[model samples]
Target: MTTTHISPEFTALLQSCGLKHVAIIMDGNRRWAKQKLLPGLVGHKKGVDALRTLVRFGSDHGLQALTVFAFSTENWQRSTEEVGYLMRLFVEALSLELAELHRNNVQIRFIGELSGLPEDLRKLIQSAHTTTATNTGLNLQIATNYGGRQEITQAMQALGNDIAAGKLKPEDITEALIQSKLYTQDLPDLDLLIRTGGESRLSNYLLWQSAYAEFYVTETLWPDFSPAAFEKAVQSFAQRERRYGQ
Candidate 1:
């Protein structure tokens, strides 16, 4: 099958933002699989392929950081088997692609609750992060078991506890301080947020980080999420005028 190739026009549209940070809420793997009469795991695997391609493309396309919402905190509500399969899939994907990502100068970072994952998978994620930390090309951040509310809550709790313990003063709790407390502390603020599967809501993805992000959503499920579709999103984003609450 031919993966959609990037067109000049799409690349031109992408120039509009200088797209320092782009986040994707990858959705609908199961639904896409259902449409194709394949098991959901197959769709997840295809999504991983798309992710690999996109990361390389982002590196070539000058995007500073690409944050992908892989699994939500609420995803734990899924069947145990499905969740287990996704964990295994993540391990397998990293196993197969780590060398290439490292070779291509991509920095892999995972943001989210690591404590909920299996010890082995957690180690795998940590190892990948450590291995790719020195690369300077694409910054690929995968949000696994992530929730916007949970992130904010955790940040707040940490700060509050710091104050209670006399490590911080309440007056020192600035927006930057809060930001530094979140999972994306070192990452750029979101410039664009793309959601697949036609979902309009944030679905608790990145609440604070996306306060000013330009939103682009589509009906394309993750398995069918093509480069062409991604280009379309960038085109749409390029045409927008950002006011930043002016």
Candidate 2:
């Protein structure tokens, strides 16, 4: 696709610095599939392969946390068939890949409204979480049925509950306090956020954690986003001087 490429030296520079917590808004699976005259489900399936590649790339590059937006709460508006296929694909991936992921020392975590998932999928997620709970390698956070605003709302609700129960005082609330109540409490704040499929928007992903994150948008589709493209994103992140409003 004649996209921009980053050199190996730049990739090394990216690995050496403060790119610990990286998140991706994976977009353009269906569009890629449509261009190739393939079914939408086929595109989604290919997106899974892209995810696997990114996970391994993250681990190899010594990333502490890698979060990917897999499905949004708004995805329910999609066709029933597509949604069903996605749910089934989620189940199948967990069933087939969890053991391998565990063996690789990847700690898998699903962040979002998991209660809305089918019971079997929920059980699989729970089992995967339990199985990989102690893995000390890459922190893999998958956002299924997740939204940035929804996460903030949920965190606020938890914070309010604590305050009402006399466990916390409203006056004591801080940014750190709100963070502690979040789904990503254990993870570090986002350092770099990438959006594939030529999209520039955050699309309601990681609103709270990406306050000062460097963003790299690419024209590459999610399914076609190779390790080279990933390095390019990191390269872009490495070049930026983050002042954080200093």
Pick out the ten consecutive residues of candidate 1 with the lowest summed lDDT: 1-10
The candidate that wins on TM-score is 2
Superposed model 2: Cα runs more than 4 Å off: 1-15
Q: Each prediction's Cα lDDT score?
A: 0.86, 0.88
Best by lDDT: 2
> What's the lDDT for residue 126 in model 2?
98
lDDT of 2 by residue, 45-67 (tens): 99998888778766755678999
Per-prediction TM-score to the true structure, in the order listed: 0.93, 0.94
Q: In model 2, which residue pairs have backbone atoms overlapping below 3 Å?
A: none
TM-score (C-alpha, index-matched) for candidate 1: 0.93
lDDT by residue for model 1 (115-200), tens: 99888889888899889989988789999989999999999999999999999999988999999899889887899999999989
